[model samples]
Target: MKIDIQKDWGKIKSHFRTCNRRNMHVVISSVDSDQMPTVTPIGSLFLNDDQTGFYFEKFATKLRKSSEQNKNICVLAVNSRKWFWLKALFKGKFSDYPGVKLYGELGEKRDATPREYRAFQRRVQSTKRLKGYHYLWKDMAQIREIKFTKAEKINLGKMTKEL
Candidate 1:
């Protein structure tokens, strides 16, 4: 069964935790009513205590904060990749620990501790076997909300239809 975006916060958080298996989430973005949806692949999602807001590390994104344009977006997460369609949903809000569409604003983000920042940078350094990999980490474009529906919501259905 599918759950409403605002009513299924805990279920959505648990789906991303990968408590018993590999976990990953995909982020979707649409700037306007008529704009096309933007999808991003992510490996990590930070769910805070109390099931408030969540955070993820992204290297680059199509939307930047300087534009002042509202980025209507939704994030889809899954607990296991084995199940092609685990679960996902639409979301909005922007603040620290906000249950709804309130994941803090975009652009105005603080950097990890100087030491931690350096470590992240180093972890992204190029390797002999792999070159030209994107090694940048930036604050998530102020996410608005997250939904916990079948992964098919974004993949099999019209969740990403071009507007």
Candidate 2:
């Protein structure tokens, strides 16, 4: 289903937030020059209020390369919460979509703003006490922006009729 990005932006953000809260990785898809598709699991994608988003560019080498070759990208965020699925199954329908696909074009890579950096830090604060947190997330000082073009609700046949 086609979604008005401006009107339904809040829902889109909610979907991402739900997935992020569960520590689920958002999947980003891009095609290389040869038309082969590459999918990357990203944990740092953040949606802005104006239908644009950014992801910390620390270890996404393949994603960055593919995006440079082809700016078009599709991001998929699935709720994947057990309670959400169980409730939907019992009702035979979903109150909201289980997932959403965001179509967008990648923008330039730039140093992240202090606000953005702090936001990222806050998101991963719970893991700060772990040693890997510094090794993995400390250098995520750069970000790549994405200007969304469209939003599509992922339909699951009759399971999504109520949505």
Candidate 3:
């Protein structure tokens, strides 16, 4: 069933938070000019209250090229914590939706504003002490906006029926 993106924005945000915590990244797929699909794992996607979000545009060459050709994209976030899945499997049902897909179009790429940069820092604060953190995220300067038009809950037979 289709999820009402406007009405379920909060739930969607929560699911993404869980996904980031459990999986550390979300998968984004876009089609190139030749209709070849490209997928990228983005660790910096952040959702806003208004059914929109942005991701830092760095280190994703294929995604950048594909977005240039076709703005349309799909983002998938799955709560893949081992415990969550084991519990669901034992109970024969999921307490909540295990995953969600958002459909949207990419907007203009621009420099990250102060507010956005700060938010990104906060999100990665726990990894700040690590050397790779500085190497990977210290210079996240560009971002691409996404205006989500639709959301769908991933269905897994009877395991997701309650959700």
- Identify the candidate with maximal lDDT: 3
lDDT, candidate 3, 31-84, per-residue tens: 987899889999999999999999999997888898877899999999988899
Model 2 clash pairs are: none
lDDT of each structure? 0.37, 0.91, 0.93
Using TM-score as the measure, the top candidate is: 3
**Higher-lDDT candidate of 1 and 2:** 2
User: 1-163 in candidate 2: lDDT tens per residue?
Assistant: 7878999999889889988897558999999777899899999999999999999988888888888679999999988889989998998888888989999999999999999999999998889989999899877889999999999998888888666
Clash number for each model: 20, 0, 0
Error in Å for residue 24 of model 2: 3.3
Tens-place lDDT per residue, model 1, 66-140, is: 214653344544333433322323222211111112222333334345544443344444432453343324322
Name the lDDT of candidate 1.
Answer: 0.37
Question: What is the lDDT for 23 in model 3?
Answer: 89
Worst 10 residues of 1 by lDDT: 93-102
